[model samples]
Target: MTFVVGPVSVRTPASSANLGPGFDALGLALSLHDDLTAEVLESKGDERLEITVTGEGAEDVPRSGDHLVVRAMNATFDLLGERPAGLRLTCVNAIPHGRGLGSSAAAIVGGIVLARALVDGGADRLDDRAAFQLAVDLEGHPDNVAAAMFGGLTIAWIDGAAAEMQRLETTVETTVFVPPEAVSTERARGLLPETVPHRDAALNAGRAALLIAALTVAPEHLISATEDRIHQSYRAGAMPESYKLLRQLRVEGIPTIISGAGPTVLSFARGIAERAPQGWAVHELAVDVEGALVR
Candidate 1:
């Protein structure tokens, strides 16, 4: 019998986390997506795993088990305590790697979804929450994973074995300004002081709370919502141009914030408007209501 297995496709949206003040707590999903295709084949004993990636960072990303997607699958299989059948994976990555686009989180979630579908009777056993847990555990963060899994603006907190998520309203059209440079999450985190002053911590807490409220209750508060007493200022040296551009946006009557850790910045505006820098390519995007899924 010929087992005609599919190149199962999974789509996960690009996300911007932390916003500015909501450190490790808030995230917003963008319209750009990472598309993955995985297929199961009766492989020869010699070829246990094979993967091919195309688009965006195809030239830069690994095409073997060392890839983050493959790592996510391996981690999932380990959790299930079963040696899964090998897979031939193909990824069409649209989101840029190390550009604050949550590309790694998307890859991790995409791999988990693909792995579940490829295994015998595994797809039926996997739930959204379960898949999300796997991605979060593998990615070591829940903000981006939650947005990739649940969609919209997501607020998540990790609690030992379980993760709690709250989906927020994404009412404005989001425009991203991606600088040419790529900033690693570790490097961004390293820029933060070991311990923020008590007053600064308190300020961030208040701003974070107000940001969440503004997302739900008052859209006008978004201007203030983008304020940060936590990460953005400290990492200004990494992407000084972004900081300068943000100030320019404020002067130009645009609401902008650092998308995630650094580098990529995002702005939310209504109507048909364009306030991006001349060299930047502005993609008119919206909130991706649907997260990672097979089609």
Candidate 2:
């Protein structure tokens, strides 16, 4: 019989995706993280799931199994080919959901990490690639998952039958402005048109390549690298202020880019004073190099 054991916890970083013209291809892991705890216990027929939330936007987050953490736990159980004896989950969310900060991906990744630790005894037996795939399945895209899993800046894509990943080093600073309100990811996705003009498609492809090149070959070119014609423009209706604010920052000598499918706007600047906009909570941050960890 499985007896009660100490809680297993996992922490995962928040991510910002799209990076202007890259759309679903480029993403970066931020220094912020979401922490999760799961306690395993002997069952007295208490098969139901329980969850508690605190920190950040916890007051508005759900405290039931229907939440993303619980859902990921269920997926883990299914993958393991065994039912969880019982799981009591607690999520301390530091990342705001739907703000293009990859809060959901964090929760999903956190759950998978905890579940693996509980079942496999440690990380040795778990397949890192499979774990990332599960997260991508949950995330509906690989951009955020790639960054959260690998840290720093990640570029991911499917290459026929296999997946490819490349991690790039970024020398520039990133400053993000998170609004008080939340924007639904589903709503942001729904706004995208099914097709784009050939010229627009070509434009985004060229800019995406240039952006990647700038991140490495010419860091100074990044001021012009953060250009887009596809997703960001179409998302303006959902976040007009972000668009206007981005343009305004550019004029102020700080180049701002839309973070993922954002309501969160990010700017690249050389220094703190140079980065701060007229009005916004500016967080000067570096990329998370260590990825996710738990002690």
Clash number for every model? 0, 0
lDDT of 2 by residue, 122-154 (tens): 455457787777878777788888888778888
- Model 1 C-alpha lDDT per residue in residues 1-295, reported as the tens digit of each score: 1223666788889998997788898988888998888776665664467777788888887777789988887777666566445677788888878888899889888888777766666755667778787788788899998998888889999887788788877666777888777888899888989888899888889888888877777778877777777788888898888888877776666667887776877777744235555666567688898888777
Residue 289: error of model 2 in Å? 1.5
Who wins the TM-score comparison?
Answer: 1
What is the TM-score of each predicted model, taking all chains together? 0.91, 0.90
Q: Give the lDDT of residue 107 in candidate 2.
A: 80
Q: Worst lDDT window (10 residues) for model 2?
A: 270-279
TM-score of 2: 0.90
